[model samples]
Target: MAVRSWVNAFAVIILSVGQASAESSSGSLASSVKRLTDKFMATGAEGTPPGIPAISVAIGRDGKLLYADGFGQASENRPATAGTIYMVGSITKQFAAAAILRLIEKGATLRHGSTLLKTTTPVSSLLDIANDWTLEGGPPITVAHLLSMTSNLPNFTRRPPHELDPWGAVPAKQLLGGMKEYRPSGYPGSFEYSNTSYFLLSEIMENVEVGGSSRDYHRILREELFTPLGLSDTGFGGDSWEANRLANPHYRRRPRFSQPDWLKGSGDVASSVIDIFKWNKALMEGQALSPQMRDLMLSDCARVDVWTYYGMGWFISHKDGTDRFFHSGTVSGYTSYNLIVRPSPAHWVSVSLLANSDGVEGVDSLADELAELALKS
Candidate 1:
């Protein structure tokens, strides 16, 4: 209640000052900026410690950035500035989606019945698994399913009864072979969240691109999507501290699995709020892909049995009598959300919250709070 009151007061003051400035040419732009900064700082100071850590948010209308701000620290006691870099987590799925779309535009074969079991790759065992990978009376696993997280492949890393492994740096084939051992839960077109499916797509993409490493595939994204869109701050690098330019992960202080680098294509990408803003712009403006390819990436790919409206890589929400397209990411201690108002697809917003915190519950609470705040804002 206090925060809401304060925001209302601040907005009124800002509007008043702007009106006064029109009458008297004495107010400097710096003064207006200072006032805005102070307003944000006041809200953040009152909102922090559990409110949200270092949020870098970019709100846009029609592919143009209207608001961008970074609040809190990149880590405990460390300030997060405009330059901080944080892991975008499952937001990496968007990049993977775009990359696969690029392959499709280039005529890579990802049609029905594209088997991904590798003969020379690390998971040589999955070649056997591929033998039985039928449609199960429906469509086979296509590249489209992989991009949309609809393959419903059991996450080999997080199988129950046994602790999920954080050491995903194992060769891609090994990951698939391990996944083959898990029991099936649903069919190919079923919508389910699984990092393993994206990693599997990454393996197949590695083979699709000529003489390209997965890193190369990502670099292609950097050069094509990010660079052209002015998202230089977003990238995948080997250093952990690179994420400091973004919010640090928040988690309760508990023993948790530590991730390894081999998980690169799945969730190892580092990015900034501004970079994602540029990404959203590029995606919506059709800068990175042809119009048809862009539609395929955003189109509904599958249906979630759990949620009537949610499907594939995106979540569905209703506000003001409209449906919103969005996705959220969580890894270890960090949680983030990306949402774009759809149909028009004009307004977009993303919030990234990081706590050196733990436990899925706390992280989820933080993400939910941040998302609610974004919706209201």
Candidate 2:
């Protein structure tokens, strides 16, 4: 996890030369981005893990990739690069949410030909648990409730010690079957972060249709979001060439293993810093979603606390009079953070960070700091 801060002057010079037009267009903000990202990765400090085994960062301003760089080893032998893929946990939810919105835009109704749109469909129509379980007179959950993490679904991670392997391969059916033991605590409209809600959403998307026949969630995402946005490196993890390029996952300096297939839409997408930047830019440019859908995705639907709100797949916050949309993911052996700051109509800045080791101090802080720096620049 030790990282040597040897600046790649040659690479910088080449990138600067190649991006002269972009620099001119951004009016010196590009230079500021480059300077800030050059120091983005942290050298391990006391109480923190030695250093990030592999860290990749990308900064975008006004829908342009201003700076991107990688540090440390992607694997045992491979040096980190802009294309080194890492499992980006809950950030995958954004793509899933986008796919749902795409289906809605295509005029897809809920299962059973219900007139309800994607957001209004009741959870009972999609999954068996909603019918079998009761919430002590609470209202039935809806698609909007799940999307906003207000479904009051029981968090599987809170299961007894025997079920604490958050990254282990648990079948989706098995996970759902066990939910009968617990009852919903919070009301349907109250905020409760639940991966199960998204997992069920994934299931619903697979069985329902937009235009004609039903499609798998992964296929829907690929066609509607990744392919259109040119996110070539992002996909489900498995024994594939893309998987081979994954920066090895680690926890406390020990190598961690890969996740199973059942995570699906909740947290099972992998991508590099550059592709993530592309996603943020596509979002900003209205390429991935219509203007109304984009507003819906970014709108604050449920309050997480006094200062934070949960939108469709994003956490919305405001700092110093600027609006921020962000999400962080933590699975076994990996942690990631993505931040987008919209300070003005003409300015948008995004920062994406992927790290191999779990519980790494400063990963989130570094992303926030870089976003702030990009905004100021």
Whole-model lDDT per candidate: 0.53, 0.74
Worst 10 residues of 1 by lDDT: 117-126
* C-alpha lDDT of residue 257 in model 1: 32
> What are the per-residue Cα lDDT tens digits for candidate 1 across 182-240?
54357545677777766765666655442232334566566656676676677764543
RMSD of each: 8.6, 4.9
What is the alpha-carbon lDDT of model 1 when measured against the actual structure? 0.53
- Candidate 2 per-residue lDDT, tens place, 155-178, comes to 655552244354566665666566
After superposing candidate 2 on the true structure, give the runs of residues whose Cα lies further than 4 Å from its correct spot: 1-14, 17-47, 110-116, 132-136, 160-168, 242-244, 253-258
Residue 369 in model 2: lDDT: 70
Residue 121 displacement (Å), model 1: 19
Candidate 1 backbone overlaps, count: 17
lDDT over C-alpha atoms for residue 136 of model 2: 42
Candidate 1: RMSD to truth? 8.6
